[model samples]
Target: MSLDNLPDGLLLEILLHLPLQSVFQCKCLSNRWCSLISTPYFTHRYVSHLHTNLQPFTLLFECKDDQSITRVLATNSDEPELKSLAAYVHRQSEHLWLEASCNDLLLWRSKDDGESSPMSVYYVINPITRQCMALPPITLPYHRSWIQAGQFRVYIVSSNTREWSESKVLCQEGFELTHFALCAVPYKSLLFWCSNSGRLLGIDPYNTRCCRSFEQPIGWELDKETDCFGVCRGYLRICQISMFYTRFSSILRIWELKDYDNEGGGKWYLEHEVSVNQLVSKKSPWLNEHVQQKYPLPLVLAFHPNDGDILYLAIELKVLLCNLRSKTVEVFCDIPHDPDTWNDKCNIINFVLPSWPTPIPFAPLQNGA
Candidate 1:
């Protein structure tokens, strides 16, 4: 019997076993194949199969430049599906800035474009399905002049809602919410925004009233510039680097949240501590020859999604993947380092690509004749 005459159930089983790229190509063979591959059941089954079989995931890096151009880099550079999605997103809106990523969905926002109002529209995009949804504009409440003594409002919206809702978050006697523009870090069902003072504002999209404040880790200094927050291997982790001026050395400490839903919030347990100076010793190739500094501080960009021991660090202009347990380092990539624009113009996003595309919830379908 010919392959075309195969039963739908058998065809789906065969297609599910193919590589992700091959499956994507199968969608273009005919309308019947396209419909078969595009069904919700197919996607769910394919994703489950990939998870059960332990398929590898790709790490996609997205950054924006001063010219409002977005650049996407992936660990698996030869993956055509991811590359195509990145290029399509770039072509759709050159000014779109990636704010956050959860699972397979990317949250992006267009630049203000010098509008008189401070609010900017947000978009949630699914690369595989090429579905885009525009969220209602949100007016920031952290404006310096708009402060109302001890309280501020946080605007939030959900995928199912068309309008934005506000929640009043009270601050301490002297503390104020100042860093509302920073990208939110999505952990489990809650989204967390970190402030310069080491405070975390967590909000639940489904429950507009469920807003909570998490204090900084015990004994942590109020230095926000050197702190990085991320989720690694099913745990919410935060990494901080401390520089010693007299000794010309730095220490990196990572903490994992124990119980996020506890009545007293969560407690951070020190998960890992590595000496940055020792990791990049004098004989290490990570040291730049041009810079004569004895100890070059490394910025923790992100943690390895699958491995808790591996970390991605940015030292000067080079990005390095360092293993804490083995004390080994490898150059991941060289990033642009323009001193003039580095501080104010750079945005980095760590995107994890699963084996199968995830369907976007509540996204409107494209019109097909």
Candidate 2:
């Protein structure tokens, strides 16, 4: 009748249904459980099961100045929880930069004293396990004599080998990139990053040099301020808002990259388009004028994993779930902020982990399950 007395197969079945965090905690209960759970066969099965169920997505907001991370469940209305990531860094570490996230694995850069060090300080974390590991540093190539050298690298831990690997990317030829728009979700064994020049670079975690490159969606200028990229149902999604200099109106378009792995360059297919005027008129009529001048259009957060018609967006300090099917908008939750105290020095940025049915443990697969 006791859990320890249960058959091994039944125990694993029960563990597979448990949340990923709980499963990780269960590993510490006993050596038998740990060995069984850590087995390659069990790990892959658990991951495969979770992927089929479609886990709910979570949002991680970074307070730039304080270097603190806040986690909120995007599926429902909930208060944000400040996650303590201090155990991973030195006590003196003040700032942790969120470079990117894929399959619930977060990539962070450590800023020590703001002075450029030849060694890169990067960390990879699995929020569920509360585990963090630092990566070996690589010196970046100098750009121009005056400008400091900055390189973008993605550190991905192999599920099979349990080893960390990184991919190095360069600025596009004939074009100078200031920053890159990190993709919301990684797709098909590739992590996609969009440069300021509207170029898409795909990083192959297995091989750094075999990386792939593609042009951005036609006619889309992915300025860091106005446009962003996300993944919905394993498709590359880009939402862009453009404003006219002469007129006060703005246009918003959402497109998906289809057959992105095509032999020829893949084509972008328009998924949905809406006008800022219509959204303002229906959602916030009072702020019609402020939208074009004072406020930027809502940034696309994440698309619903099961429901293709639903997507999340951030406007002002609120996260809204916009449904294309009903043409309705509802507030999912509010971004954490202090109204009593106003400080212009604080850094705040919002991000959503778009990978649905988040990837499971890294244990290699055995024979067929």
Candidate 3:
């Protein structure tokens, strides 16, 4: 019997073993295959299979310049599909800005011109499915500016609705919500923003009223530049570097949020602590050259999604992978620009591509009526 004559159950089983890109190509063979691959059941099963087999995910570094050109670097440059996805997004629009990235969805913003304005359009895209949904335009209040006082508005788009909604978050009386909007971190069902004062603001997109602020982790200093926050191994984690002013020694501490909804706001447990100088000297001496300088401290770019002990660090223009357990460091890749240039215009995003395409939740009436 031919492959086309195979039963649906058997065909699905075979397709699940193929690579993600191959499965995408299989969809174009016929409408029947496309429908089968697009079903929720197929996606669920395929994702489970990928997890069981330990499919590796890629990391993307995005740098934006003055001309609105975004430069993306992927850890796994050998993968054609990953490179194509990055190229596709840039090709779509030169002025496109990547706002935030969740599990399988990427939130993008496009301005009407080269300058900032209130009339900005947002889009939610799934690279795997090659689908895009453009949200309704947003108009801010005329009186208040983007960072006026201690108030900021968050625009939210839900899978159930075709239109976008807004939520206002009030900060502490004296604190200003500066730079936090550009570095919003999406984890689980809530979005988290860390202020320069080391305070954390979390909000649930589904319910705008459920917003809360948590104190900074113990030992973290306010207005310090040696800290970074990210999610690792299914937990929210933060990495902080403390230096000894007298000596050239610095200690790196990793903290994990054990409980966030407790009465004390949240509880953080010290996960890992290691000496930066010793770790670098033992394995990679090149990185230790810059450790003595107090001005340019090593920056933590991201943590390994599957392994909590592995970390990605930027020492200057080069990115290195350090394993805490083995006390070893290796250069992962070198970036063309300075890593310290990451600011409002430049960003480093950690993207993990899901095995199966997530269905775009566009409302039925969005296409018409």
TM-scores vs. true structure, each candidate? 0.80, 0.69, 0.84
> Which digits, one per residue and each the tens of the lDDT, describe model 3 over residues 54-116?
335555566666555655564744655576666665565666777777766777777455245
Which candidate model has the greater lDDT, 1 or 2? 1
Q: What is the lDDT of residue 342 in candidate 1?
A: 49
The predictions' CA RMSDs to the true structure, in order, are 4.2, 7.1, 4.2
**Of 1 and 2, which scores higher on TM-score?**
1
Evaluated with TM-score, which candidate comes out highest? 3
lDDT order of candidates, best first? 3, 1, 2
lDDT of 3: 0.70
Q: Taking the tens digit of each residue's C-alpha lDDT, what string does model 1 give over 1-369? A: 877899999999999988776787798898889999999999989988878543233444444555656464535455555666566655656666667777667788877755476788888877765667888887764443534246656667756657787777655554544333356677767777655455666777677467777777775767544367777877877777777678776677788888766465687888887766556433466353322264356666677777888888765666677888876676777665532234434566666667676666545425320
In candidate 2, what are the lDDT values of residues 70-143, reduced to their tens digit? 43333462312112222222222345556666655667766544346645567666554555566656554432
For candidate 2, which ten residues in a row score worst on lDDT?
79-88
